[model samples]
Target: MFIKIPLHISGLWYPIITNNPLTTGSIGAGINIALYLTAKLRNTEKCGILLNNEEVLKDHSRAICGKLGVNLSVDEKSPISLGYGFGLSAACLLGLSLSSLLVKNITIEKATWPAHVAEVIYNTGYGDVIAEFYGGLEIRVKPGPPGIGVVEHIYPGRKVDLIVSVLPGREDTPSMLKRIGKETYDLARKLIDELLEKPSVEEFFVKAHVFTSKIFSYDNIDKLLSPYRSKIIGYFRKKQALVLWVENEWLDEIYSYLNKYFLSFKTWIDMYGVRFENTS
Candidate 1:
C-alpha cells in the first residue's frame, strides 16, 4: 500500500530555537507547495526514505516506526533542497505518520503525535508539523508538542506566486537557535502581534521583510536584486534560501531576472495538507 502527502513552505514569523521548555515556541505562517511524498509499505520491518532522488538518513522515520510498530518505504521528491526552510523534514515525518495511520487504522491524533514529538526532540523544527497537518496559512500562537501547541490560520483572499531560490548550502537550525537571545525573541513577538492585528498579503510581506532584515542581514540580497525592486513585494531568508513574494502578473519578469543569478521556481499555495492513498 502507498500514501501521499504534500510539502510545505513556511514564512517563519518568529523562529523559536531553544530547547528550554519555557522559551522554545515558534510563530510562523506557511503554504503547502506542489512537492509531495509517496510512501509504500516494505515487506520487511525497517523503514527507508528517499529525498529528492537522494537517499537520506532515516533515523527520525525509524524512530517513528519503532514507536508505532509499522514499517514503510518512502520516496519524497521536490525541486528545492532539504533544510532550506522548505519544511522537508516535517513533511517526511507527517507523510510517514499519515501512511501508518491509514494502513493500521489508527486515529489521526495518534498517528501524527510521533512526528511532532520527533521534530521537537531533534530540534529540526517546531510548529511545522502542526501547521502542515492543518493546511493553509497558519500562525503558531503557542508552541509545544503537536497537541500541546496552539495555531490559527490567516486567510489572505488572493493567491500570489512564491518565487523561491535555493542557495548553495543549508542552515543548521539548532546552531542558529543557540545563538539567539531574549532580545530577538522579544522583537519577533512584537512583529507577529502587529501583523496579526490586521493580516493582509501586503502587510505580511512588509512585516516579514522587516523581521528577516532585522534578524538576518539582507544587505547583500538588496544589492543583488536592485533592478527588480519595484516588482518584488518583499524578500526573506529561510534557513539557507531566499523567498520572494511577487504578484502573479509580475511572475515572469521577476523569475527571468532571478533565474539569471540563482536556481528559481514559481509555485502556488496548497490549501490541503497531508493526504492518503491505498495502492495495494
Candidate 2:
C-alpha cells in the first residue's frame, strides 16, 4: 500500500500573562488530522511517505514505530534539501516508514498509489494559534498533536509589552528544547506561578509580536545575519515586541525575510490574531 498524506499545520502556544502555570496550550484548526492518520496507516520499508511538514512525518513515524518493534535509518540524501518546519525530524520520519513497511507486508517496488485524496492544506500555528484564541502570552502546553487545554491566569494586574523582531534566520525548536532542557521550562513555569500569585486589579492588552526564526544555534544565526544583523535588531527594537526567532515562516513580510536570508522566520497570520493583509 502506498501512503501519501497531507500534512496539517496546527496552531501554536503563545505566552499570556496568566496566573495558571500551564501558560501553554494549542487550538486546533479542525482540518486534516484524520487524513494524516490514514496515510500513516499504509506504511512499509519500501513504501514510505511524501509529506510537506516534517513534524507530521515525525509524529507518524513515532506512532508507527511504537506499534512495531523496529528501527529504520533515515535517508539524508535528498536531491535538494529544504527546511522542513519548526521542531521536525526527518530521521524519525524515515524510521517510521521503514517500520511501516515491515508490518504491512508490502515492498516499495510494488506499491501503487494515486494522487493524495485529502490534499487539503490548512494553515495553522502553535504559539500564534494559542494567543489568537486565548489571547495574551502563552507557552505551547503540548507538542505532538494540536489540542487545547484549560489554562487559568491567577494574576490579573501586571502587564508586559513585547517588542518582537524578525531576525533573518531560523532557530530549531527541538534543538532549543534539548539545549534549554528543563531549565527553560522550569523558568517559564516559575514565571507563570509568579503571575498567578500577584493578580492585577485591571486588564491590559499588550501589543506584541513574537517573531520566530529558523536559525537554530546562536552561532549559525550570527553567520546568516552577518550582513544586516544590526538592521534587523533595529527593526524589532523600533517595533518593541519581544523577539522570538523560530525555524519556520508563519506570516508575511516576516516570511520574505526568511527567503531573503535563505532561512525560515516565524510570523503570525490568522493563527496569532494577525489579520492577513491583502497584497493583491
Q: Against the true structure, whose TM-score is highest?
A: 1
Please tell me which predicted candidate would have the highest lDDT against the true structure. Answer: 1
Residue-level lDDT for 191 in candidate 1: 70
Model 2: per-residue Cα lDDT over 20-109, one tens digit each:
322322321111111112123332333334433333443343443443444332332221122233211322242234334544565431
Give each model a TM-score.
Answer: 0.86, 0.32
Instruction: Give the poorly placed runs of model 2, Cα more than 4 Å off.
Output: 1-48, 52-59, 62-177, 192-258, 264-267, 272-280
RMSD of 1: 3.0
Error of 1 at 255 (Å): 0.9
- Residue pairs in clash, model 1: none
Please give the TM-score that candidate 1 achieves against the real structure.
Answer: 0.86
- lDDT of each candidate versus the true structure: 0.69, 0.28
Please give, for residues 1-280, the per-residue lDDT of candidate 1 as tens digits: 5555566655655666565533455676555555555555443455766766676647787887777787865666556656877777877777666667546877875688777767767778776787777666666777754566677777768776778777665667678666767776677788778767877666766666766665566777889878878778766776666778786788998888888878887766567666666555
